[model samples]
Target: MDPAGGCPHAVNARLRTRGAVAPVVLPGEVEGAVVLGHEALKDFLAHPDVAKDPRHFTALHEGRIAEGWPLRTFATVRGMTTADGADHRRLRSLVSRAFTTRRVAELRPDVEALTDRLLDGLEGAAAAGRGVADLRRHFAMPLPMGVIGELLGVDAEYRDRLHHLSSRVVATDLGPEEVLAANRELPALLGTIAAAKAAHPGDDLIGALIAAREEDGDRLAPEELIGTLVLMIVAGHETTLNLITNAVRALCAHRDQLALVRDGRAGWADVVEETLRWDAPVSYFPFRYPVRDLTVGGAVVRRGTPVLAGYSAAGRDPAAHGPDADRFDVTRSARPEAARHLSLGHGAHYCLGAPLARLEATVALERLFARFPELDIAVPEHALAPHAGFVGNSVRDLPVRLHP
Candidate 1:
């Protein structure tokens, strides 16, 4: 994995030289295999023998994976992301009851309003500065963060802390002690919020989760409640934040592609799908374990070794998306194979927040361009620093001159 995460495609191209499923080093010097081939990823993502439960991981079970290992937080969490089969079904079912289709649909007006409000903030910032503002800070970051915060019923005072801790969760550069401290602080903070919600329950998702837990503690344990909230609050906004930021960056870099949407040759949906493929929001998802020896992309993955889904690499696989796979063409999503990019994931463990993410990104991009049709990158595209982490793929900051 690229520690800088700036040139994941370059890293993937080099890794593909070894094989689709190549051995790699994880954050804690853990040996892992990443499935980089497009078809191989699609197959293994839904493979019956592959599982996500950390219990399947031999290193963790053998006490090799330390408690302070940065990625431990993800695998050890007792949420749908880390569960399998029956347990996964039960946890997902409980969460689905709260995060329903109606709840997501109900957020459209709020998302639109938030988008406009953020755009207004961007205009203000650009006016105060030299006609330049960070789109990531003013627009891309806040839009989804606000929506997810609202959906989860996170209080305003706790949101900054929530965002800070969640960002730490994906950071691969943290030392063991820092990792340990953050791990403790995050759950403690969330527990405080959970206690508050329990005292004054409402129609929000957290209240609904609390109600579910109160109804049957066995169905949704206290740990599982915190884990689920962690998953929702973190995964919800971070992915969408990068998606919107990446989309804006891609469109600005390739005005021809943006013109396709503006000229009706393609739609914003096409841009979203193409951006997802060409530059995935997630570079690598953590830790899937094979139940037994499995041949993935011609490499035999032994049972219990961590397997990472190389979403960034798989998206641009030439075998899957043709010779010009690296190109950022909005028109590419029209192709049948292009529509199958695993940006949102696959199989039973597919991202539960996919609809909300797509909705947020779509609304955000559409409204942002409508508000500032003349928006362009303030600096050269290559100068934009990549977000520091192997898991999340995005620019650290998107400097743009919003010509509103």
Candidate 2:
């Protein structure tokens, strides 16, 4: 697949015709394989021979991947995202305790309050003759940012800078120096936050992680602490931001489906699921290396070759979702046998923040529509550009009218 700057979904749709696992050109003209079939990608995710650690990646370990490679920032992280087996379990275990369902439940009030505040801000802007608002900037972006920031004990003062640095980490269009700069700045910022939390601990996730020590004298190392926080903030913030943005965009485009939600024919949960299946928030995730040479979808992937899990492509795979997979239907998930979308991920590395993301999106969408049922896109759908980089899927901005 060529790296054209148009809609990634369209490119992926053509790739699907090639087979389940298709070769593609990533940014920086890098060669990689993307798993396009739904079942094929699922197997790729949970396969024992597949791995997340960069050490197993041949190109990265052999110095073929340069320090300034656009995607190098992602593959080289020391976080739980790059850990394997026991180490992965240990790191995930430490943080999993903090992201408990009850904890997510407790955050609902904060999410609701934040959602209301953002909607109020949007209403004020619309009434002030602004005529339109970038929901992505004013609403979709901040809701999760505020929630994760609150959860991590990060001050509001640091939220904007943290997000800017985090955006650079996923941007494939950035130059080597820019990528390198962000690579340095993000962890440094997280470290500063970690150090400050160390000086004054609070009942937040970062504080808990700082104070956590396992029974066998295991504790998060210095780098692991920063890496874990980066993962929590970046992954936690970006994925949900796109999910909310994509859901709103899809509902606007398919008002008939939105009408289903309005008439009580479908719930907001269905809207969330349909948007996930039709236009997943994460287009493709990088750098899953095969420990041994493996065959996927009739393609032989060499051992140690980097494989990308095409979550967005697989979500709409015709083989898995049938011929009408591309169609966005709010009632699809209501079927007892409907397939679950992997937008949040699967297997041992499934997103720890899934519950929180779902909660935020559901609450955000429900409250957003309730507050402004006449909400509509301010610009043509075709005019909206995709988010930079392949890792996070979303429009650059969601311009919408709070009134007519």
The sequence of per-residue lDDT tens digits that candidate 1 reaches over residues 1-404 is 54545678888989999988899988767888999998899899999999999999999999998888888987898799999998898888876754567877887898898888888899999998889999998888788788878877987788878888888887777888988988888888989999999999977888878777433456468999999988988898899989999999899889888888999999888888888898999989997999999999999999998998999999999898999988898888777665479988999998888878888888989998988898999999779887877888998898899873
TM-score of each: 0.96, 0.97
Candidate 1 off by > 4 Å: 2-4, 98-102, 213-217, 336-339
lDDT of each: 0.86, 0.87
Model 1 Cα displacement at 295 (Å)?
A: 0.6
What is the lDDT for 81 in model 2? 92
Would you list the clashing residue pairs of candidate 2? Answer: none
Model 2 over residues 1-404: C-alpha lDDT tens digits? 33324477888978878899988877766678999888888888999999999898888887888788878967988888999999999899988975789989988888899999998898877777477888998898899999999988999999999989988887787788988899999999999989999999998889999998878998889988988988988987888899999999988888898899989999998888888888888888887999998999889998988888898898888777878898999998877878888877889999998889889999999999998888999999889987887777888888899887
